[model samples]
Target: MKTAALSVSSEECFQPGLIPRSPRLLETLLANLDGMVYRCRADAQRTMEFVSEGCLPLTGHLPEALLLNQQLSFEQLIHEDDRELVRWHIGECLRQRRRFDVECRIVCADGSVRWVWDRGVAIYNATGEVEAVEGFMQDVTERKEAAQALQEAERRYRSIFENAIEGVFQTTPDGTYIAVNPALARIYGYRSPEDLIVSLRDIRHQLYVESERRSEFMRLMEQHGSVSNFESRVYRRDGDIIWISENARAVHDDAGTLMFYEGTVEAITERKLYEAEIRHQATHDALTGLPNRNMLHDHLQRAIQARQKGSMTVVAFVDLDQFKYINDSLGHQVGDELLKTVAQRLLSCLRDTDMVARQGGDEFVLVLQNQSGEAGIAEVMQRILAAVARPWPVGEREFHITSSIGVSRYPEDGKDVETLLKKADSAMYKAKEQGRNNFQFFAPWMDTQVSNRLDMLISLRRALDQEEFRLFYQPKLSLSNGRIIGAEALIRWQSPEQSMVAPDRFIPFAEEAGLIVPIGEWVLRTACRQNRAWQDAGLLAIPVAVNISPRQMNQSLIDFVANVLRDSGLAASWLELEITENVVMKDAEKTVATLHALKSLGLKISVDDFGTGYSSLSYLRRFPVDALKIDKSFVRDIARDADSAAIVKAVISLAHILNLRVIAEGVEDEQQHDFLRENGCDEVQGYYFGKPMSVEDFTLRLRDEAIRGAAGK
Candidate 1:
């Protein structure tokens, strides 16, 4: 492609001889100049005398059109908006024979405007004749646009910096306040930004409530060159401390020297308080305000880790035995208050390092660290039992509750948290079975007991199939009348190996394995059949009582007893149902309905283990019962313990007032017998009278008693 160029003339001698000789060199030089250079004649309309092809791009007009006057004139090319200004600057410079400089906008042929800086010198003849002018016009559009953009961005940034909710600032390395926004002034309790910069000279001593916080902040910034989410408490202008979170970065000089920090500061006192509340809610029980299970697990884990060398760690499950009675009788609000009091008493039983957690409901778990042996565990357990058994004032009445503790140790009973908890729970059951208000240590033998229970559970099903279970009758003597009145049919297991299994050892197993339903049916049928046999044998007509488990009592026991009596052809008066205090007190309304239904069949309902449960006199009176069997514990200690004697008298008196007969159990001596007789007890049955006997032995005793009565001996 061919290009065009021009040579400078003597008439336009502004830097003459600067033009290149070769057209290509001229073209290259002009294109690289960034603006066009032009020389035109001083005509009525200034005509282009010599033009560089660069003019085509700069003015958006081809050089040929301008040179031949086919395009608009040069003066007319100046934007009309600024033509007078440009012409004035050029005319004035020529009249004074000096250089001219003007900044103006020129309209291109494409109608777009360009900003240009024009600098020119006027040339004249020696005789002072009119001459030509020459200048360089360079584009200044890029610089103009960049300056405008910078201004707009600054405006927006300044608005945000001033109005932001968080504090914004720049601080020097030496802690001097360089600049602060308006929001910072408001946050720091300053009247204005200048007031903060002037008054708060020492950020470490003046701003921070704790001076060490400043040292920490500076140390972090030095190490990382930035600190994000840096939180601290600082004093405002009025000396009130508030929490703040910072996000900051270091701003260095051109040489990368440590300069200053620029950052945003947010007030987080409210959020910090909210987070603390959430943490408290997470760790504390809502009802009792005691430490909850989450905190307990955490404390237990910590205690396990901090266990002393060569010492055992004990984790105890402390459970209130009859708490449900109180909860169901009273209201939940009262229950909550009672639990709180219990938690306080439990906390008093342990050291500060030990934790007592409300493991949900009326159950609590405790962690004991560095115990010497079973002795240490026993001591803590006793303390806990005593503390919980202390009388509590619930509403108007002074209520008392007892706790059962199961202790599991580390390295012996269990090695992990879950195992320890399970063993502790098992031990707790043992404590409850031992009549609550006491503690039991975790033993390797306890594991054997559990394994035996599992083995019994598997064998119980087969035993029912093989008829390995049998019934033994324990006679309940009428102490007032001194005659055979009724008998308790106790279930016993005779293994295929001819081993006699205690009822205590296997009854609980059968109940847990769901085999009691069938075994209890067998006992009922056998007892009824034996009672019919005694009637046929012409012996004294006595009702044979059979114990029904809580599980069995949950079924239609009234209908079952009626069916058994009908099948065996035994009168309803010849069969009686014996139930424990726990079974009756579990669901009082249901128990009352069941008892009434059975009483309608002319069968007697007797509560076993009386004075041993959380039965209220109000609920007891509501039961359709004929007899109350005093718990053996009270009878065992009636001769020695004054409390036992008083309890026995109270129970008998209460039973009589309710129109129920009272019977005493576990009378092992003449002293116990005399005690019961003196207390006005109506019946007594224990080892002192006769131990539980097999069916054949009881039948033989009946025959012997009948012979003696027939002779009136």
Candidate 2:
């Protein structure tokens, strides 16, 4: 922080009679002990007419000798560089008859440098003709140094304000963006500050996504005279919403009248994302991306508050049965996929207005708003059961898992969030007791098992290690050949100690326990390895498809798949990843990224259970999928049902239009197979041919097929 040196010389002076002065006033001012006062001719060389006593203190020259136009005049004391400029200023002021001020350096008689401020005005004679210039001078070395320092400081601040990384803004009291630095304009996605000002006339309405945000802002301003950490969702110029935080204050005038507000706006999109992820970690199931315990409590409370008369809110507690044995025996990888699949199916069953939350390990709570008592709740429960029962492809297998749903209604079950949740949870046990894949309304007698969740956890963990798991593969047939093309891997568990454990039983539990990440990795590796073994045993290298859980499909999945392919020595084209519709829909961009990454490794990507997911036709083209596998539910009735047939046909046409292959699953008869093949299905898989088999059994069957083929040739 350095500044240029500055000073004023005596020859630089110009004086004017802008103010009428009393005769004695000038004499009294000159008598004061600090600086000199003088009058000089407005000429090339300033000729002195008057000088004050203070001249002795600065230049060691007496006033009488300087004032009488002596040989040692004011111009002689000025630094040579400044002498002419000072006279020029005096000449201009005299000719213009205006006030003048100048600063320059002077070399005193003692050879010391001094800074001075010369304030002057033009002196005119009674005839209104220019005569001379008169002014007062001060030894302003200290003040001049301070002024130079201030100018430098202003320059630095101005530079930073213009080139700052974060946006800075000054707004009017009523929330209009008055002035915004360049950085702010960029942050708001505007081309320039002028454009931003012209377009964003009303910040509260134009910038904030919600109108009520203005009220919140005003409230904060009123309460605290300022606001910090004030976050709101706002729109960029292109209407893309982002989050920003403002540290702002109300600027007031001298009398405390409100002038305007000035604030610093930090584009916190990245920070907001990080904060949201942290919040997600705290209140969401890491594996399923569904709300967890803490968030569920908040949702329940909100539901209770929104409860309407006659139309009661319903809370359904869903628990997957037999999930533990599948996890322990087959591996946690299969278990995690089961949970993610279940979560997705549950989400598909509910409306966007409803809430589907995972309340830790095998327990899911759903909030149905304004339902018409038990009947309304029953329909939802049935849909939940159907969705859970629908076949899902796991690794290289296809299996089914069932859920037990317990319902509790507002007021009838309990009035409070916790009470309703507790009742619904207890009733879930009743559904489990009656039979899996059924729904039960809350009853007072079912309270006994509500507090036994710990026991359920223990049972699940034990199921996994006890070798209760089994694999079920659904057939995939070539449409042209009428032959099994491949199979989708699925898993099941039959527990000796517990009759049978469903995937829904322990999948959620493992996910909530953070065991899904490792578990999912295992499924990928195991399925790939199993497929490679089948190929090495002389079976046609059909794509062995494995479902990818969302948690496993992120960044790490890319590396994991590449590693598994290397270890198994399998070509990427031989492996297909069955990703559900919902996973791709959650974050279209990120999902596209994950799909591309897998695709880049030469693996085939298929949209599993295609019709059952939230489909955005616009984004379908962006997915790096090789095929769309129709859900079993659609294929189950595609042969006889017109609507199912229509949907199936449309999906096939759509898939073909997108250059994606179509595969039909759950074709239980020849008619279904004929219909699928006639519709140009690239492949078909279901009970029509064979169910899933062990790796050895599958290889033996392939050998038999090859022997048959050779005999026919």
Candidate 3:
């Protein structure tokens, strides 16, 4: 067997003893080396021929223990798991005559595990047979542990990116996506993350529904470098629009130069819709679906702002005329339907720029923007009036309703929204006062007039509570015999400060203020109690009639009357209730039902002030009345006015045909008395018989009348 010759320069090929080598230099170099330099035979248990001093620190073994395998073989130091692999690798490298490198674990003398990198070239003889292996072994445990840790951290991050609920994304500053997770793809309605990344090239155009949103996003990013809860509408892959919220930050390098944007996206479409619905409910009326007072105030404020820019706006306050009558008589259900219908009609009459809002109950505020003066406003007002007046069926019958609108123009009718609305409301009351179903523009003088009316309303309510109201009775005489049959009770207010206030002054105000219900109740109870007291005092037993206003008829009048009769201990036959002709015809069906209920209590029902309201013969026939009282207008001029004379004569004939007694009111002179008596009138109540007087005076008059009747008998 022969050995391969070493390839070296002649100057480098010297023996250590001949070259006079420095022992300290060699020892210093070898001690600082990371691993032990070795030469060993290629065997199953590699036989180490020589080893460096670095071996002591690397394997915790002395060089003598490893040399020639006298104490321990180098193969025994290799970890059990890597011994076979090490032998196979070394064998293959020796056969191919090439250098070999491998990583494996080794057990130190202390029984501790350490990872090492071993590199060697095969040493061969002249015949190409393996002789030995020479290599350096270095401890690489720190690098290996660090690399494994980095790999574990990457695995966790990838797992989180894949499984997160919120969409995660990385995009360039120019809105080009670099990476996207599955959640991001799902939010964008795409099949996969790769598909989204490929299809959405320009996020500004392909993702955002509005182009301006991209600009806004850029602006925010430039200003703050980050945005949290930035909400906007965006388009999906399917082109369906949805709302999304993003929390993002501009990713920058060490030099503070923007590299890309990384963010999270959340589908907030459902939340956005819910917020919109909540806003609508807050600003709109529940029943009529019109803008409510809150929204109206906002609109009016805007209108006022426009006025400052030299634009004219009309604030029209509309009130449904006689709505309370319909509400009280028919029911609130019908009233609600009527209000909804009115709202729709008002909307139809206005332009898109105009707004109509419910100010609450039968009252609506209309805003006419950029109006061209009175002419344009008038035209729209007329259309609204006509639309509201058009007959519509409610329940089973057709009903016709009208609106009284009051308008106040901006700059001319005060400056602010509150002032404009106040003026418009004042004008609406003027329209009502002037005979409703019309429109009125605000006038400065209307303020004083409305104030007076308001004062009267306050005073009237006080009078009712203070028991300052008194009932005055006027004797009703039989036209044929000139005998007292009954007395009509009239209300009068004896104010503590004003002395006396006429019924004409406060009654209308009471009706408008909704104070009439309680006042009417007081009048009924007082009148019935007086009548019962007179009969208990052994006076006349003639029935006493109480006038019922139209407002009173809308309430539970039958129940009130029944309660009054029961409380007063007066026979129902001795109490007669007189309702106006117009009241019964307002809601004919409801009135008929009420009249029947009242008549069932054995009370006499009379149609007072008849022939004034245009009552239909068909509905009038259904009324359960015992008497019909001719209105004062007809009786006042019966002797001279041929129209009045004919109406009175025909009324008597009509009453006779219907089996009802006819009574004429306001007969003040001899001629009026003669005409009514000659027309076969059953009873007459007027100044011609006797004027209305106080309770004490009426009691004395009743006593004298009773004595006179007894003398006549």
Candidate 4:
């Protein structure tokens, strides 16, 4: 740092203790001063005329050595590098008739360099002849070094500010740019900092894509004195959007008033895009490219919450029919294509606000929202069904597809995601039961049915393990001679915790829950053993009919029945397996083969509920069965319903034409029996003969009937 020398009068120079005759006190003060005090001749050498004792430390020499020319002159004491500079400053000050104030390094007696400030003025004689110069001299080496260090720090900081990669900026509180680095100009797509500063004057309105972002930045700065990683979308000079994060603080003046904001900025657009992709993968199904279960759960929960605000939300569980068979037959690659196609179809049937998520496999869950009755839910379902049913061509083959959908409404069918999904699933099965290719809304009754079915399924398994089941027989009497020729064994469940559960209450459920297969085997083994015991006791040789469920028939029925009979030591002829008419027609060829296999083992086969199925004369002629039992539904209306009576007669005639003995079941009155007897029905089994009874009761009845027949004969 340098400063201009001030004009100084002769009196001013004398005031610094340069009087011609100094008092003792003034002399002492001059000798004790912090710096060298001197009066020198105005000659070229500037030979010292007077010198204070302080010069000993300032120049590393005794006062006597410097006075006059006894030792090296003060002019020689000035460093070689600064001698000309010092002389020029002093000469310039003298020409201006002012004082000289110059800083230069002076060499000490030990040859060490020290910086000093020299200030002096010329003294004139009474005739205006320049006499000598007098003033104070101070050693300022430490101050000079400190100033040099500060200048070096400032230079390095400026270099770094120009070259840093991160965009650095300083702006006033009112959003005017005070300064910006070159990197900031490059990031914002400007030619230079000058171009950026001039073109983007209003930071609030011009820089940010979202108009309020700048305001938010200001607010954070106001509240916390700083904003770290404050991110936002911003517009570049070319109007392209980019993401940025800023770390800034409000710069304050000494009195704590905000002056400006300074910060560093980073472009984060690519990082933001990558993070979005990760989030999408986490929430979406990979195969179908639809929302996965994780997303479904979150979306459904949000919809359920929204239901509180008077808006309707529907959850539809869609299951593709025969998907497993198709997937297995065509391979997983085709299955994946099928799923992808169905997902697109489902999406087409829905609005942008609606969600269709792939729950997994062949199942998808749909969420429909804000459906006003004016714009019907049924209409949406119809569109979806039609979309799914469209012909899907895979390679050379074009195939038609179908789906079963169950709908559950928010705040009505259910109030939560899990409950709605579960109920919708149950209703989807009901759609399948109603013959597939349709949709059904969840009903309250369906819940009860589902709950009861679940409880019965658990109970059924426990019943098998605990022996809570027993078989009761209903006598099948011969219409020709009033003889007991056969008895149908009906299962009765006597649970330890509840009343006896009739077969009708749980039999269908057992079949659905896949519990009937094992239950059927248990019935077969138990009935065989009991029949063998009855024959050993010398009772009549009557076949006991154990009804086979459709589920059991699909399994290895022939082997299971043969195993039971062999184990029981019961002849196959005395154990008839009764199958429902519908069960036989399901897969007639397979059923026929299984029946023939059983017959070769000497077991008789009877078709139960004979009149209530897809029964054809050709199929009947083909079935190698011993008898056809008429379903109780028609028999219940036999006397009054002429159509019922006509149907019954036709069935009997059909059975006889096929050489199958015709039996009428569910007879509850004498009128029904008399009608069966006169109509040529070969056998009758009903409550009229006797309601289903225990084994002991059946034995007693057989003995009583035998006694009566003998007496009548």
RMSD of each: 10.9, 15.0, 10.1, 15.7
Q: Estimate every model's Cα lDDT from 0 to 1.
A: 0.83, 0.79, 0.87, 0.86
| C-alpha TM-scores of all predictions | 0.51, 0.47, 0.62, 0.51
Candidate 1 residue-wise lDDT, 183-235, digit = tens: 88988999999999999999999998888988888898889988999999999
Task: Show where candidate 3 strays beyond 4 Å.
Answer: 1-199, 218-226, 247-271, 284-291, 308-314, 318-357, 360-410, 428-441, 476-483, 496-499, 547-573, 577-691
Query: Candidate 2 on 1-713: residue-level lDDT in tens?
Result: 00000112333333475555554454555567588777777564667766766777867766666664564767877888998898788667767777888888888767888898888887677999767777878899998889989999999989988999888888887778888899999989999989998889888788899989888988888788899988889999998999988899988999989888888988888988998899889989899999988998898888788777778888899999877545543446777888888899999988887989988777788988888756667777888899898987865667788989888888788988889988887888788889788989988877756555656566556655664555555557788875656777775556666765666776676665665565566567777877787778777667788887766755577888898999989899888889877667766777788778778999888898889755779889988888998999999998679999999999999999999999887878989888887889898877777776666677776777777767878
Per-residue lDDT for 329-440 in model 4, tens only? 4556778999999999999988888999999889999998876652598889889999999999977778789999998888777878899999999899889889999999
Identify the leading candidate in terms of lDDT. 3
Clash count list over all predictions? 0, 36, 0, 0
- Candidate 3 lDDT by residue in tens digits, 459-539: 887888899999999999998888899998999999887897789988878877888888888988999899989999999
Pairs in clash, predicted candidate 4: none
Best by TM-score: 3
| Residue 609 CA displacement from its true place in model 3, Å | 6.3
- What's the CA error at residue 3 for candidate 1, in Å? 20
